[model samples]
Target: MTRSELLNDLEQSLTRLVDGMLVDKGRSIEFLTRLDRLDDIAIDMARGINADARLAGFFADNTPWLLDEDLTTAQKGRAGTLFAEITDLLAARTDEEGLKLGREAEEWSRAMGGRPLRLVLRATREEASLSDRFHALLRREAEEVNMLLAEREHLMTCLDDVLSSAELKRDRMHHHLAASLIYFLKMEGYKVEPYVRRLRRITEILEKEKPC
Candidate 1:
């Protein structure tokens, strides 16, 4: 079944189970709050998956240009190293790592001057002095690297938020299902197993989409 259909089924089943319970009003409120939290986490997880897919596509498309053989060996090596470092930093999703990588990338870009850099620098040659052209190339590359670093940082933040939310929901769900209410529902002949099963399936899907 589609995700929306599964979510609807789960919500309806939970609603029915909650309605049949003889719990106090406070307990009912807690159950509903947990349900809402789970739903929000699921939705955010899906959004994060979609965002990661787009970022992967972006990297795939742009990476080859940086690896082009026309660029100098040093330029290509730096580009490859930066890509690797950025990927690792993004996976870790720490601001400190990102800032360190950003500084390294900026320094590398400034020192890098090859065919691609020369081409761009030559374009504005008429408008710039020799020293200005040199600085211009450095600035251009620095700006590009900074933009990429910012994008990676933003994507990593989104990924970290989704992962944390998913973990929180998982713990909450475990606690909620282990409560006496779940036992009461099962004793009443309610089919609550399917809800848990569906949730597991959704978690598996998210796992497959997770970044390496």
Candidate 2:
């Protein structure tokens, strides 16, 4: 074959390979986007749970001491308003609505004699619950991502085997890309580990003792 003809054939082959890679990348991106949306919803649910947990804990912690005092009608009104504000925020899905409610709750809590120490303790309890729920979802997602990674790896491995049998050089490029994708998922899974461990520890302690 003439040199020009050989070059032309090679160019066509590379073009087709690039097109296939683009298609695969598009599929991967779409799948990951869906995963991202699921993650966002899980986070929002966990946040709502955290908000409600905080309000409940605040009342539990302070109602004892506050009830001992002869609270004014205005003080009682503000406390009820704070509780309602927190409840509203817990029910809110939109960030704007939640933020507005959060601000109102903060103001009401302050006006109703919320102490910083009590607030901190209540916040910790809320955060613990949020972490617990988030970790549960995270573990499930991790397993899903791991399964996806394994599937992709298996497919890529098969592709590599086929390409090797056919003596195709392009398979090397695909194998490289597949490995990179797997590494990215592993990195993300690693990022979620600490929270999972925290949740596990909390669960262990809770199981060991009964709530009074």
Candidate 3:
């Protein structure tokens, strides 16, 4: 594969690994503990890249500063750009919308003097987090995957408690957060989920979501 192809493959592999880590936190820790496997894969990829004579020749022929022993401005720019690309890929943040929000937030921060502007931006971010993470679950899994009917009912009751609370419903972001929290509980299987508090603390944090 070409260098771009190799990098794209690595990015896809990393993104899938991150998704697996998010979905299975318990096993993810075990996977993380076995860092040697990751090291081996990275080393193998590096060796494969090094073995690509044409890939090296392409870089040598195109890059004027390739043979420079001293780090030039071009080298610094390339390094910074590559680092940013890797960061964006790993974070799954390819959209310009988040950057647009940030630029707007910066302008508002200058106008409003920091704290107040931050509250508004926080609200915006929380609102933007409305993507339903549990939407992709198979219908049969939700019905029959290692969960009893009673446990499912228990989860439903918990969700009801969140929705039924006047306190949670007072603020839209809090309401959304409560729904998300419950969705996660259900997704993780109701039998193994933790107890829900009155959510007073979360609401208190949600206090910041109220832009002055």
Candidate 4:
């Protein structure tokens, strides 16, 4: 395939990847919110009970009406199922395992910041470098990507702080983390569009040039 055709294909693939990531991110936020809400309800229900048995007995004695009161019928059903799944997950995981998973998630979010554009540029570096204007444009795009990466890193750090804090309630922590992720994605996604446009421009210029 021609260089322009290759870049166009790559851009389309990356766009699809970005869309998928956004959808996954939305679902992840929803999952975390549900878990946090359940945790809050469990904590409330466990009041005056022994600390160790609280989580274990959360859904044991009787299903709490609190969930029904607070959630829609569909949400209540989903929450019940999710609670069971979370119980199984907690049973299977040690504190260390849980911490490791949290760290992995944070690392994955950090790594995702500028990866799509970086991969595209790396794949087409030779053709992009052929024209000084295109090369300079790529540099500018890289700088913009870095700026977005820095912003996302800062937001992610704020999210980590919220997650790590003992003072914040589960509900507050969930809101903060969800807002931070959505904001980070919004700002980061904005950067991708411009970079994609610049890439298309570079490809168009390359297409117009005769082979040496």
In every candidate, how many clashes are there?
A: 0, 0, 0, 0
Scored by lDDT, model 1 comes in at 0.42
Q: Which candidate number would show the highest lDDT if scored against the true structure? A: 2
Q: Per-residue CA lDDT of candidate 3, range 54-107, in tens?
A: 322323442443233343333233222222222222233345643443343233
Give the candidate order by descending TM-score.
2, 4, 1, 3
Give the alpha carbon lDDT tens digit for every residue of 102-161 in model 4.
343233223322121122344466664345324433433333233334334565443443
lDDT for position 100 in model 4: 49
Better of 2 and 3 by lDDT: 2
lDDT for model 2, please. 0.43
How far is 75's C-alpha from truth in model 2 (Å)? 54
lDDT of each: 0.42, 0.43, 0.38, 0.42
Residue 184 of model 4, lDDT score = 64
Residue 130 error, candidate 1, Å: 38
TM-score of each: 0.19, 0.31, 0.17, 0.29
Per lDDT, what order, best first? Answer: 2, 1, 4, 3
| Candidate 4: worst-modelled 10 consecutive residues by lDDT | 111-120
Model 4 TM: 0.29
**Top of the candidates by TM-score:** 2
The residue ranges of model 4 lying beyond 4 angstroms of the native Cα positions read 48-165, 170-212
- Candidate 1, after superposition: displacement of residue 116 in Å? 25
Per-residue lDDT, model 2, residue 180, is 41
Candidate 1 per-residue lDDT, tens place, 71-177, comes to 43433443433333333223434566445543543443344331222223444556554554345335433432333343345433323333344445543322333
lDDT of 4 at 112: 27
TM-score for model 3?
0.17
